[model samples]
Target: MELLFVFLGGAIFGTIARYTLPHRDEHGSVLVPAIGAVVASVVWVALTWLGWAWDGGWIWWVSLGASVIAVVVADLAIGRHRVQTDAALLTKLTGSTATATAH
Candidate 1:
């Protein structure tokens, strides 16, 4: 199905985001790609519901583009938040401002 192609494209974009972004080690290998695929699926469905033709070229562009943007944003935000939270936890437990080592 065309949906499968969209999912695959989204996942590929997500994989790129995962490896290209910092703090990749903080999250599971599947997380970024999964997020991408899901976002792409959601976007595609939403567009279809809005009356966009499934066979339209623009639909695919928008869906996959949205997925890539979502993946990168989410990856960056989650990575930053995890680092901050981990550092805070470490500092609390150790009674020092010790930071986590970057991978």
Candidate 2:
């Protein structure tokens, strides 16, 4: 019951976090949602150890907000790698030809 709720909460948090972020061509997929789920699971475990119970009230709201922040921060930090990888791919695809013409 509680475990199920935690997972559901995580899914919701991940979805919202993914929606809130800018549409990066690299991250415009299910990765953010998956990351969110992992983040939620970690938070749930920590909270459980701290004796926090989710009764679906203010505590839940706080936990949700925290989880969202965690997801956003993690995405921002880890997403740089994805962006760099995408940039490298783009550069490779475009080749070394430098176009002087303005778009």
Candidate 3:
């Protein structure tokens, strides 16, 4: 089915985008692909229900576009959270503690 193709394409695009991010190691392997598939599936279903036929090129375009966008936004949010968390941990651990000895 065309919907299947669109979902698969979206998954590939989304996964690539996520993995290509600067902080790819911060995320789990499945997170990007899973979210991509979900977003793509949801968009495909919604547009079809709204009368956009599966055969129409717009259906593929819209679904895949939404999936990519969702992945990008998710990456930004997750990356920012990781940065903040790391900064907080560092601050807590290095609280101006220093030792000095007079010779």
Candidate 4:
């Protein structure tokens, strides 16, 4: 089905994003791709409900684009948050400023 293809496309894009982006070490390998597939699937279903034809070109574009956006944004946000949290934890445990040491 078209949905399956879209889901696979989203997952592929997500896999690409996961490897391409920095701070990938912060999360599991599956996380980014999973996010991508979910975003694409949700967008596709929503658009179909809102009257976009399933076979239309624009629908595919919008759905896939949304998946990429969601995947990238989530990856970046999670990476940054993890880094900050880790730094804070390090500072708390060692009683020294991790940020200061990095600079």
- Among these predictions, the greatest lDDT belongs to 4
lDDT of each: 0.92, 0.68, 0.82, 0.94
lDDT of 3 by residue, 1-103 (tens): 7767877887798789887876677778778877888899999999989999888888888899999999888877887898889877766777632411221
Which residue pairs come into collision in candidate 1?
none
Name the candidate, 2 or 3, with the larger lDDT value.
3
Q: Tell me the spans in candidate 1 whose CA falls farther than 4 Å from its real position.
A: 98-103
Tens-digit lDDT track for model 2 on 1-103?
7656766787777787777776434465667667666666677767777877666465566556667887788667667877777778876877633632222
Task: State the TM-score for model 2.
Answer: 0.65
Between candidates 2 and 4, name the one with more favorable lDDT: 4
CA RMSD of all predictions: 3.8, 3.7, 3.8, 3.0
Error of 2 at 90 (Å): 3.5
Q: What is the per-residue lDDT of model 4 for residues 20-92, given as tens digits with 9 covering 90 to 100? A: 9999999999999999999999999999999999988999999999999999999999999999999888888
Candidate 2 local distance difference test against the native: 0.68
Superior by lDDT: candidate 1 or candidate 4: 4
**Which residue runs of candidate 4 sit more than 4 Å off their true CA positions?**
98-103
**What tens digits encode model 1's per-residue C-alpha lDDT throughout 1-103?**
9889999999999999999999899899999999999999999999999999999999999999999899999999999999999978887876674333331
Per-structure clash totals for the candidates = 0, 0, 0, 0
| TM-score against native, each model | 0.91, 0.65, 0.82, 0.92
Worst 10 residues of 3 by lDDT: 94-103
User: Which 10-residue span in candidate 1 carries the lowest summed lDDT?
Assistant: 94-103
The prediction achieving the highest TM-score against the true structure is 4
